[model samples]
Target chain A: EPEVTQTPSHQVTQMGQEVILRCVPISNHLYFYWYRQILGQKVEFLVSFYNNEISEKSEIFDDQFSVERPDGSNFTLKIRSTKLEDSAMYFCATSQGVYNSPLHFGNGTRLTVT
Target chain B: GENVGLHLPTLSVQEGDNSIINCAYSNSASDYFIWYKQESGKGPQFIIDIRSNMDKRQGQRVTVLLNKTVKHLSLQIAATQPGDSAVYFCAESPSGGSQGNLIFGKGTKLSVKP
Candidate 1:
């Protein structure tokens, strides 16, 4: 089965520094998404990308957060300035562009903002 | 105010027992629902999904039931094993949004005892 792949399974960044998390979604998948789960908490949607543009984003995806499908297959999430509270497990997922399609998620990138 | 939520934050079951996780959604227009399982350090894995048109769908040892009238969703796992211990989340997507954009519920941690 095809799987989404995220780089740097773990990353530790200093506060106020910029960090870009990279993901390679399934090759044929057209919709990409980013979600985060704080330790022992619920997973929260960050943003969804389709057609090279953001389709939807949650309030948590503020000015400091941005997403890009830099290449046809590489979906990336960049945080302009990391905060201590930004420490969490960031997951990248992808799905076919059909309604009700199930998302395939990557193992996740553990971002530790110190 | 669209939101998906679980009935309980945690559940405990014996290895051979059946485990049921429940969820509720406030969106009457939500037509697609999915259940995902997340182990301690991994991303959410798709377990099962049900559309509003179907009341029940089964896969392997897992089953998903959707009640559109009541805006409820449930996942059932039979003969649970130690590997089944994980946080289970239910997510919903309203029609007309990005096909894969989902609103996740606060997950329920399932503990299976051997």
Candidate 2:
């Protein structure tokens, strides 16, 4: 069973500072996604990537947020300026790019903006 | 304005008892649905999934039911154990040529007594 792995289990940053979270999805998976869960809130979809480009994104993924597969195995999300409202657990997931395929998720990176 | 939502916020069941969590989706075009379990401080783990074409699917001790007419989804856990205590979310995807985004429901916290 393959798994997605994320780095920096917990992150604390000052408001307006830049931050980058990294994730390594299961090998051989073709689709990747980023989602966020605010405290006591539902998991919200932020963006989905496939074939090295963003296939779709939610309104929450504004100009401040960007994603890149810097390398073959690493997917990274960068926030140019962290805001207080950005405090949440960010999860990275991957799937086989087929309908109804399960999305395997990483443990998550908790970002706390001060 | 499609949304996924749960009927309850929390549930408690004795060890060895069965547990059920329910959700509703407003999207008539949704093609797939999944249930995820998240322990505190972790990302969601996929439990089970069902497609609109199927009414029931079972895996291990868990079962998922999809009722498309009323836009309802449910997860059933038999002989719930302490490890089953977690927050559960039902997610839907309108993947029939859609960009493949998942809408997650407000989670329901399930607590299994020892």
Candidate 3:
């Protein structure tokens, strides 16, 4: 029943400010990911991380966004300059393998930009 | 771009009844599929998954059926309870892609009433 844990369940920031969302994935998981869900929209893939580097990213994952596995257990997403459109629920997920295995998600961090 | 979509935006079911949600994908290369439940203000929670090689997979009170030829997926919940009310999403991943990188469909909201 291990779960991914996120910090700052809710965050409000001014447009143009910097924000960092943190997540601690399951201990044994080898792959980590970041996804975002805009209100009333489908959850969108942002980036995937494995072996300490980005494995793949979507178009939505632009220069303003970055992800890091800063430690053995911590994975983080940093937005250099938040825009109003950046407001969404950011989710962190992990999986034991790259195929056939289910991804486990965190409760999510709600990012609201004013 | 490939996309995953649900047939309906919302479904209402009486408590103790069975519920079924359907999804369609446009990607023929996708070999893995997963169903997730997202309560309001939360991240997507894994429900069940089926690989292209399997036509069906069951877990607890839920069953997932896959039609690889038609690129269709369905989730069935037996004896649905009020707690089962949530938005259900179907996600797809291409063969040989990172497991954490998933393409999600617009969710179908399920409302269970007593």
The TM-scores of all predictions, comma-separated, are 0.91, 0.94, 0.94
Candidate 1 yields a Cα-based lDDT of 0.87
lDDT of each: 0.87, 0.88, 0.88
Lowest-sum lDDT 10-residue window in model 1 chain B = B1-10
Model 2 per-residue lDDT tens digits across residues B1-114: 111243448899999999999998868898889999988777889999888889999999999988888999999999999999988889998755444488888878898999
- The residue-by-residue lDDT of candidate 1 on B1-114, one tens digit each, is 101243447899999999999999768888899999987667889999888889999999999999888888999999999999988889999877667778888878899999
State the lDDT of candidate 3 residue by residue for A62-102, as single tens digits.
99999998777799999999999999889999999746789
**Per-candidate chain B TM:** 0.91, 0.89, 0.91
Candidate scoring better on TM-score of 1 and 2: 2
State the DockQ of every prediction. 0.44, 0.42, 0.47
Maximum-DockQ candidate: 3
Give the alpha carbon lDDT tens digit for every residue of A1-114 in model 1.
888899989999999999999999888998999998777566788899889999999899999999987767789999999999999889999998777889989999999999
lDDT tens readout by residue for model 3, B1-114: 001243448899999999999999868999889999987767789999888989999999999999988889999999999999988999998877766678898878899999
Badly placed stretches (over 4 Å) of model 1 are B1-8
Model 1 chain A scores worst on lDDT over the 10 consecutive residues at: A36-45
